[model samples]
Target chain A: MAATTEFELVSPGRLLLSEPVEMVVVPGTDGDFGALPQHAPMLSTVRPGVINIYKGGRVARRLFVAGGFAEVTQERCTVLADEAIDLAEITPAEVQQRLQAADDQVKEARNPEEKAAADRARGLAQALAEAASAAAHAHA
Target chain B: MASLKDLRARISSVKSTRKITSAMKMVAASRLRRAQEAAEAARPYAQRMERMLSNLAASVAGQAGAPPLLAGTGADKVHLLVVMTANRGLCGGFNSSIVRAARHRVLELRAQGKTVKLLCVGRKGRDVLKREFADDIIGTFEEQGSKGITYTEADRVAQDILRRFEAGEFDTCTLVYNRFRSAISQIVTLQQVVPFLPSPAGNDNQGAHGGHEAEAHALYEYEPSEEAILADLLPKCVGIQVYRGLLENYASEQGARMTAMDNATRNAGEMIKKLTLTYNRTRQAQITKELIEIISGAEAL
Candidate 1:
């Protein structure tokens, strides 16, 4: 529909994805929101969660994005994410490993600051793991 | 008088120095490319931030409910000057130029009877400011192995400044740096961090291919009220600003260093050429003198 509204997603080190996906979902800090062609201009913080993009008529091109920002202008929705991963490339095992490591970090934290940081890592890792699994199940 | 051998040695030394300077110039040039790319990459973020900030500023000023970052501390008694310079020397006047600008501002502010505290980011800037305002500098921030200046680094610095601001250490803040214009030119810049006021005429100076009304009075909706959002945004804004400054400084440093080294290499080459000519002349004169002396002695005998 409407040639899959053109949108560009960029991250540091390199330009990750640039395609006219049908609908791109963003995990804003407030909540997860999806955008199509001709969306309203909005700026919001992004939470650490899965950014499920529906390329090819709302049924393809899924991705998992870490926390950062999602700014939507007239025709372009830019995701300034800290980290983004193509669900196709993200193995569930990797997330589980990170989750385990984060769990250990939180458990062994000696100070309040370290504990808080580790807690954040743990929360982020758990969310990532869940998102990755969900993507795998939905695709299967 | 120096002998021909000494001239030859001096020529060789100058030639070696030229090689070193030329190598340094190439290194600086390559580094400059990456630094400039980073600076370019950071521009969009800076623009968006400034846009959001200006919009928020308007909202804050209108309701008299703006955060401390936008509304300011309502006091102009104390000032903080955060000066950023390069770490190493041989960058020509890049470091000195920024220090000079900061010194001028410090003098002007001091004359107005304002209490000021200085914060130096780079080693060169710190060394220069410490000479006069040694006791005033509360912090010197330049760690080599920190994996470049990150958002966290900026946050920490901002936290220190804000902590001091809250504690009444300083009521005002200013940052001095060099803005990279081109490979050969960098303009010394001074920006006010606190009492954030977006230039009213900023839109008037926009590029020919842009909008005005949208830019002049754009509005921002707060998911959790303006104040709360501002509370979170202020510190992040500080971090972003510092990060931008660091990036800009990185590019400017490499640019200045490259130009400086290029000039040095050229000067060294000139000196070597003159030395070599003098060495050849001295050797030729020595040979002629020996030949004439031998002829005279033979004639006398």
Candidate 2:
């Protein structure tokens, strides 16, 4: 049996998942990093992307996180996501609609602060769209 | 004495009032359970966030380049009071108690020669505080989390506050809200959120395991330096604090409403009982008077 690290995925609304996993890859602000058992403690900001959870030597599940933070310790890896969605559950149409709304927001933004927020939203939407397409391809 | 018809009307009115109050009580009870569950579910994230923040804060404390959100503006002249209350009015003294506490703080700050500004989160607080502090009110947010309190709603408020802070609007920020204790009791709490006061060591949930956690924290590495992460986390901390306050306020509102409706229902039941007794007594007296009249008429015959 492979050594597993406890993985916890939490959102502001609820605790989404808590269990032992062989490996987990998080999309950090700098880059994607995988945490395995006995990993050194590290803290980083999560980017808007997909997090892949590995179990039994294969990818078991994928979750899309908008943005938040992640903390990795030796025994556990916890990701506090601002928003999370199952990659399998999101449809292409929904992703497209979100991207369109984000684009509109970006165009209508008046000030730098508004523009920055809109840009962040646009980035998240774009990421979601990419993740959705990738998931569809993988499934097909 | 009232007529039998009036007594009957009064009894029926009381009966209807009882029914309405009982219905409200049931509704509030169900809502309270849901609100409680929401609050409970959000605890772990909040706790972990706070724990990690405090750990990072401890490492960065007393540094020259600490973020203002954690280091503060180095002054306490101006204060921002974020009063959180329910939008509706039927929740007993829940809103008033929070408002009263805020008002008291305002007066105290005034006495201390400190400038106070009001940022009300709910409609009821604004309505109550407007009479005296109309000029002091910077903003009022109504219909927030009308369906249920969500993080996005809280983030919006936090962003507004953060913007104001960036513009040098206030030096300190305090949140006044009702902390849910139980279904019948809600304690008015005044929590200072700004300047990021870490929770006391003794109050940590990881009391027994603190040594182990602290050892791990000492050896932990930061991705973009502690200062950068702290800068990012502080604003999020404000959002999380607001989220926590909103959630607690919501649960407290439901609990308070449940208790208040329960009391109203009981009072109405008592009123109905008294009205029924009065109606019966009045009917019997009228029957006796009619009987006496009939007996007198028969004797005359």
Off by over 4 Å in 1: A1-22, A36-43, A59-63, A71-110, B146-149, B199-209, B212-220
Q: Pick the candidate with the highest lDDT.
A: 2
- lDDT measured at residue B44 in model 2 versus the true structure, 0 to 100: 72
Measured against the true structure, the TM-scores of the candidates, in listed sequence, are 0.87, 0.92
Q: Write the per-residue lDDT of candidate 2 for residues A42-105, one digit (tens) a residue.
A: 8898889999999999989999999888988888899999999999888888989999999999
Chain B TM-scores, listed for every candidate in order, come to 0.93, 0.94
Which window of ten consecutive residues has the lowest lDDT sum in model 2 chain A? A87-96
Against the true structure, what is model 1's DockQ?
0.28
Q: Summarize candidate 2's per-residue lDDT along B1-301 as a digit string, tens digits.
A: 9998888888888888888888988988998998888877887787778777877777777889788899899999999999999998888999999999999999999999999999999999999999999999999888665468878888888998999999999999998888777899988888887888854311445564455554444556777677777888889988988888888889999999999999999999888888888888888999999999999999999
DockQ of each candidate's interface versus the true one? 0.28, 0.66
Q: Candidate 1 on B108-185: residue-level lDDT in tens? A: 999999988898888999998899999889898876333344556666677777777777787778878887877789
Whole-model lDDT per candidate: 0.75, 0.88
